[model samples]
Target: MRDNTRPLSPHLQVYRPQITSILSILHRMTGVTLALAALLLTYWLASAAYGPEAFGRAQVLLESWFGRLVLFGFTFSLFYHMCNGIRHLGWDMLWGFDMPRLRITGAIVVITSLSLTVLSWLMAYGHVGKL
Candidate 1:
């Protein structure tokens, strides 16, 4: 009774990507990124507790260019997750369900996340005043 050549259900190839779906996916991906980044943070803290030599080695790794890149990604993922979570809160309140409002809010979430990430980095690097 089943056709092997046909999909069992509608799938990715059957639908065009939409903002809602894309944002939802990114929200999940960012959550995973944050979880992994937390492990890195734990390693840094544990290294400090282990001793100065361990701490210094951790610092050298964290301060390297690749480390900075990972840190930057973690920062962006953090902001993105936070902003999207707030958007979900709004949705839970029965807000922004209209297509136009959904689009606008999604854009707002992305722009705010990127702006916050840049500002945080600037502050971290002492390029901006302490908040």
Candidate 2:
């Protein structure tokens, strides 16, 4: 009698990612970054409520080029995570099960996420609005 309590599954390190797997990992990473970004936003808001001095420092930090870049990345991550989450929910309902549909939807998720992110920042910075 063989004891199969430990199934002969391949180790994670042995497995190379296909496109879907890579996108799945990116989804989780973006979600985590979005969460941290939310917390940072809350901290900045609280600083604003604290006093003028607190608000001034927060504003200075936010105005810094590096800080603005970080915020921009966070904004993009937020949208990317949301788009990917919707894709996962669709899959949960047994949608996009075909290989072609999966690939197309995956591409759409990535492309729209990037496009929307850029568009959002452009609008926020008060430059381009349409397209």
Among these predictions, the greatest TM-score belongs to 1
Candidate 2: what lDDT?
A: 0.86
Model 1 alpha-carbon miss at residue 55, Å: 1.0
Estimated TM-score for each candidate: 0.86, 0.83
RMSD of each: 3.5, 4.8
lDDT tens digits by residue: candidate 2, 41-73: 998999989999998999899879988998888
lDDT, residue 86, model 1? 95
Clashing pairs in 1: none
Sliding window of 10 residues with minimal summed lDDT for model 1:
6-15
Candidate 2 segments exceeding 4 Å error: 1-12, 127-131
